[model samples]
Target: MESVFEAFLSFYLNPGFFYGTVLVVLLILFISIFYRLFPNSGFSILFDYFFEKMYDFFEDILGNEEKKWIKTYVVILFFVILISNLLGVFLEILVPVFGNIADTDVSLLKKYIDIPTADINFNIAMALIGLLIIIFEQFRALGFGKALYEYFPIFGKNYLPYTRGNLNPIFDWPLFILVKIFDLIISLFLGLLEIVGHFAKVISLSFRLFGNVTSGGMLLAMLVGAISGLTLTYLNFEFPVLGPVILYFQSLLVALIQALVFPLLIAIFIKVAKFA
Candidate 1:
């Protein structure tokens, strides 16, 4: 367990993780201080407004029954993705200073100061966790037996043989055999398809988040590189002012959208599972 914990920490050695962690900590501290210092301030008012909006957003989609437990999960998922998406923008401001302090080149720091959502491993893990929650919720709503049949409906009673009395070899044998064969084929096909669909959900969820964030990060990096090269080669300015401005606005919008979308989809999945 100790080794496993150490390995996890090693994964965040890059500047992205450093800045992301610091920003999250600082955000919590800021909120705490504001709440304590001025309970009736605009900061609290704005926060309450945002929280109510988010609560209503999920509550509308999940309905009242599920809104109780599932709201917590949705909130957690939204904030984590939101922070990760915003991390790239924060890195834009902090990377140069950190690079200089570490005596590392700017080029090296750029790669390290990436958005966490851009990391496929993080996206995949989050997707898998969402998938697992759906499965677990289904099992809780419907017992294990029913949940098993839900995923592989072929195993349900409807597909099984209805053996009422002793079979007649002459009259029922042929028809019974045909029905059994047909049932087996249909069940196998549907079961395999259902299994494949579950796997596909994981792939789709992970790739959707990963691809969007990664592409945005890459675009920002490319713009920064191009602008820096041109300015250094042709102009007198050392910093690329346009790149940062563009990245800030673009990343901010993308971050909010992706963060909202991910949790929204997860909530939908949970709803589907509950109804299924």
Candidate 2:
């Protein structure tokens, strides 16, 4: 178990692990304070209303039967991605405030805080988890036997029903045997393709998120690094500052879109599996 935990930690390599953990704790405290101060205020009412709307939007896709489970999963996924994305902004804020106080080098600060979703390993892990949920839903909806048949029909008892019971040895038996052999060959070929497709799903999902978040972070980092470098080299305390502002806003938009898109795709995958 210890080795497994280490392997998992190594896989994620969360740059913001410490800072992110601290932010999460601060977030919890903020929410607690908000509830205490304005339990019946318009702000709290509006917040609940917005949450309900978001929940209903996803619930509609999942339908009434599985809405609760699907909504819960989606909500959690959305917030996780959102928090990871916002961590970039949080780092930006902290750098200016804490940079002077901590007296740390710019490079050190950059190394410390990272958007978790920007890490390919983290995205891959999330994609794999989503895939597992998809598979679990398939099994829940179709049962083990039917789900297995969906993937590899040749092993299923009903794949060639005619070969199950005895038949006339001279006539019916010969045709049955031939059909069974043909079915087996076709199923085996399709099963291989099906396995490949499932693996493709994992890669596709992971890369989609990893590419978006990583690119956004790279752009932001380049902007900041360039500005900071010029300031140090030129010995100028002021710069246009518009470049970083524009980049920051762009990063914020990308973060929101990517966070929403990841969970939206997962929900769609679940829906497809349900109907498959």
Candidate 3:
């Protein structure tokens, strides 16, 4: 009982967990109120443009009119990642600096400077959701036989991806049987590998997002620290300001591209599974 209590407290007391929960709740509340109260604000205008652009982007990737049903999900996913990425850059900087307020118990926030998407558990959870969606979409779009066919194409078909049967010019009966047996074993091996590769996609997707976001957050944190710690004796003009500005744009591009790429790849996977 004591160990269980300690475990529960450790998890619930974590500053990162607390900050993530509070910030997400606050963000959702602010957006709900902001849109309802001020429909024509500049942020609303910007959001409208972003929505249209993202619609076109997802439509191009997932083109069929039948697939339009998922547009809302895709758009929401893009915004979630993009917003989290943007926050990672700003909050990591802000939380450490302003989080030290003595009057408030929120000073614990300083220790939780890492971004949400930077956490491996968070990325893996999202990736697992994608995995579930992939399975569901494949089954719904392709039906059970065809969807299963994707992984076991060579098993029941008695055919390889390429031409087969008697590569030897001469009619050697035993040699032909040997060749077919070898090819059959190889094809079965490959089909099993295909199934493994499908699950591996989740790991690849998780690691890609985790690595990019975490690296970007860490890089920005270090750059900010180095710039702020610079001495007067080291330099006069602040050319150092340009370093972060340039890196900031680069991180912005990375964040946007990754946000798009993760969903785009999922769409492509579904499309391929359907067609296969």
lDDT of each: 0.74, 0.72, 0.70
Point out the worst 10-residue segment of candidate 2 by lDDT: 98-107
Q: Which residue pairs collide in model 3, if any?
A: none
- lDDT by residue (tens digit), candidate 2, 1-276: 448755665577654554555565576467658967997988678767766776787788777788476688887777678877887665764554444324644434555556567667778889889889988998899888877777777653345557434666677877877777877877777767777877888898889988987666656666776887787678765543766778788878887888888888888888888765
Residue by residue across 1-276, what tens digits does model 1's lDDT show?
547655666675655555555666676677769878897999798877776789888988888877476787887678778877786667655654554435543445554445567667778888889888888888888889877875666533347575534667676777776777777777767767767877888898889998888777667767776787889888977678877787779888988999999889888888888766
Query: Residue 263's C-alpha lDDT in candidate 2?
Result: 83
Please provide TM-scores, in order, for all candidate models, with all chains considered together.
0.75, 0.72, 0.77
lDDT of 3 by residue, 108-175 (tens): 44455445676777778877787777777878888997777666755444553344454655655666
Whichever of 2 and 3 has more TM-score, that candidate is: 3
Clashes of each: 0, 0, 0
Report clash pairs, candidate 2.
none
RMSD of 1: 5.3
Candidate with the greatest TM-score versus the true structure: 3
Model 2 alpha-carbon drift over 4 Å, by segment: 1-15, 25-29, 93-106, 155-183, 224-237
Model 3 earns a TM-score of 0.77
lDDT of 3: 0.70
Whole-model lDDT for model 2 versus the true structure? 0.72
Instruction: Rank the models by lDDT, top first.
Output: 1, 2, 3
